[model samples]
Structure formats: structure tokens, C-alpha cells
Target: MKPWILGLTGGIGSGKSAVAQHFIDLGVHLVDADHAARWVVEPGKPALSKIVEHFGGELLQADGQLDRTALRKRIFANADDRRWLEALLHPLIGQEIMQYLARAQSPYAILVSPLLIESGQHTMTQRVLVVDAPEQLQIQRTMARDQSSDEQVQAILKAQASREERLRHADDVLLNDRDLAWLQSEVERLHHFYLSLRGGQV
Candidate 1:
């Protein structure tokens, strides 16, 4: 039987990683789409070879690893290129996620993806949990953490689903604009709620 899954998502700098770690602390297995995405495009991976064939060797560094920053710039600058890259990578990432989830020993698993709703990965889960913060807060946090410029952050935000759209699809929302202690408390509450849900349904 398929294991129960909770899809977790948030925009960049929205504290999804912090919330995910709290769930990890409570013993839930996690499948991260970002990790899967990177895995699929690693040095020896078929996806990376295909990418090189399509975009040229300039997309790879001297170490043969993908030049992610270069690729990011290319895709974000062109909608068609972005769509093409997504079409190539999303299926591979989905396959990786499912394989990991199937092996999880935890009672329930969490699938974390920044593009969960946009990429249709939410369909794999029973529920969607969105971590939310104000747009300005997101920008500030991202700039601090990644050393990204204001324009770069703005471009990333433009690529993701709007904050309101994410909230609209959320089965649960973790408002992460406050301090860490409050966030941890909310995670604990949700952990119990999820456990209760499992008992009732399965």
C-alpha cells in the first residue's frame, strides 16, 4: 500500500527548511524535491548529459559539475527555456521522490518542494502544508541567507507562485514570520494533529 504523505511547500526564505527540520525531529521521513533535482543533474547522471548536449559544455564547470548559476540565469531569462528544462527534469525528480518515499520507515512521510503546487507534486500527497511569510520578509531573509541582490530575489519571487495562491491551496498554513520558539510550538501542534489524522484514517 502507498504510504500516507504530507506535501510541504513554501516560497524561498519562508522557513520551510526550519519547519521541515522540526518534523524530522519528530521522526517523519522527508523527501526533498530540491535534493532530487540536484541528484538527477549530477556529473554522471543522464539528465546532466542531456542538458550539456542541449545547452553546450559551457553549462558545466571545469570539475564537470553543472554550473547551476549559469543554468539558472538562462532559464529564468526565457520562459520557453524554463518550460523545457522543467519538462526534462520534473519527471526524473518525481521518480526519485517516489522511490525515496516508498522506502520510508516512518509512519508518515513529508514531501518538501518549493514548487510543489506549481509542479503538480502535491497530487502525490494527501495534504498540502504551506509555510508562509510576508513578501518583503521573504526578500529580506533570502538576501541575508543567500547574499542575493534585490533584483535577483525579485526575479525568483516572480518565478514562484504568488503568496496568496499558495495559501489558497494550503490544507494547513504555518505562518513563519515570528521567532523560532513560536514556530517550533506550532510544529509540535501540527505534529500531533497529523498523528491523530493517521490514527483516524489508517
Candidate 2:
């Protein structure tokens, strides 16, 4: 049987990872989209070969792996390239995500993605969970954690779905303006809620 999928998403620095970690600690399987994206482009994968063919072999490192930093610069500058890359990668990533979900033994598994809403991943889930914070806090935290410039972080936020749009799709919401202890407690509430929904004793 397909396990229930609890899709978790948030903007940069909105604490999606922190919330997902709490769920992970409670034994929920984590099928991370970012990890699946990378997996689809591993050295032996067909997706990697297609990327190298289209962008040139220089996109590969001396070790014959993708040079993600270089590719990010190119794609960000050109919309056509971005679309082409997305067309190549998204399907492969989706397959990997489905495979992980199939093997998960938890009452449910969480598919954690920054682009869950924008990439249409929420359609595959039983519930959409948004980890949200104010836009300013998102900017501040992303700048600190990623060592990114304000301009860079702001650009990323611009490309993502607006905060309102994310909230509009949420079946559950985690407001992450407080400390870690508070976040953990809220996660506990949601954890039990999920268990209850699945008809399991918690």
C-alpha cells in the first residue's frame, strides 16, 4: 500500500528543515526532494549525461560529476536554460521520491521540499504542511545560515511562491517565530495529529 505522504514546504529560512527534523526524530521517514534531485544526477545516471550533453562537458568536474555552482549561475541568468534543466530533472526526481515513499515503513512519510508548492508536489500528498515565518525573518535567517548576500536571498524569495500562496495550500501550518523548544512542542502536537488521522494509537 502507498503510505500517506505529508508534504512539508517553506520559504528559505522558514524552518522547514527544523520542523522536518522534529518529525524525523519521531520516526517519520524523510524523503527529501533536494536529495532526490541530486540522486537523479549522480555520475551513473542518464539525467547527468543529458545535462552534460546539453550544457557541455565543462559542466562536469575532474571527477566527472556535475559542477552545481557553475550550472546555478548559468540557469539563473537565462530562463530558457532554467526551463530546459527543469524539464530534464523534475521527472527523474519525482521517480526517486516515489520509490522512497514506497519503501517507508512509518505510518506516513514526509516529503520535504522548498519547492513543494511551486513544483506541484503537494498534489501527491495527503496533507500539505507549511513552516512559515515573516519575510524579514526569512531574509535574516537565510543571510546568516547560507552566508548569502541580501540581494541573493531576496532574489531567491522573489522566485519562490509568495508567502500568502503557500499558506493558501496548507492543511497544517507551523509558525516558527519562537525558539527551538517551542518548535519542538508544536511538532509533537502535529505528530500526534498525523498519527490520529492515520487511525494509529499514539
lDDT tens per residue, model 2, 87-153: 9898888999999888989888889999999999887788888999988999999999999999999
Q: What is the lDDT of residue 197 in candidate 2?
A: 76
Clashing pairs in 2: none
RMSD of each: 2.3, 2.3
- CA lDDT of 56 in candidate 2? 95
Q: How many residue pairs clash (N, CA or C atoms closer than 3 angstroms) in each of the candidate models, in the order given? A: 0, 0
Q: How do the predictions measure up, each by TM-score?
A: 0.88, 0.93
Winner by TM-score: 2
148 in model 1: Cα distance from truth in Å?
Answer: 4.0
RMSD to native, candidate 1: 2.3
Q: How accurate is candidate 2 locally (lDDT)?
A: 0.90
| lDDT over C-alpha atoms for residue 86 of model 1 | 89
Clashes of 2: 0
Candidate 2's C-alpha runs over 4 A off are: 199-202
Residue-level lDDT tens digits of model 1 in 76-168: 899998888989998999999999999978767899999998899988888899999988999999999999999999999998998888898
Q: Which TM-score value belongs to model 2?
A: 0.93
lDDT of the candidates, in the order given: 0.91, 0.90
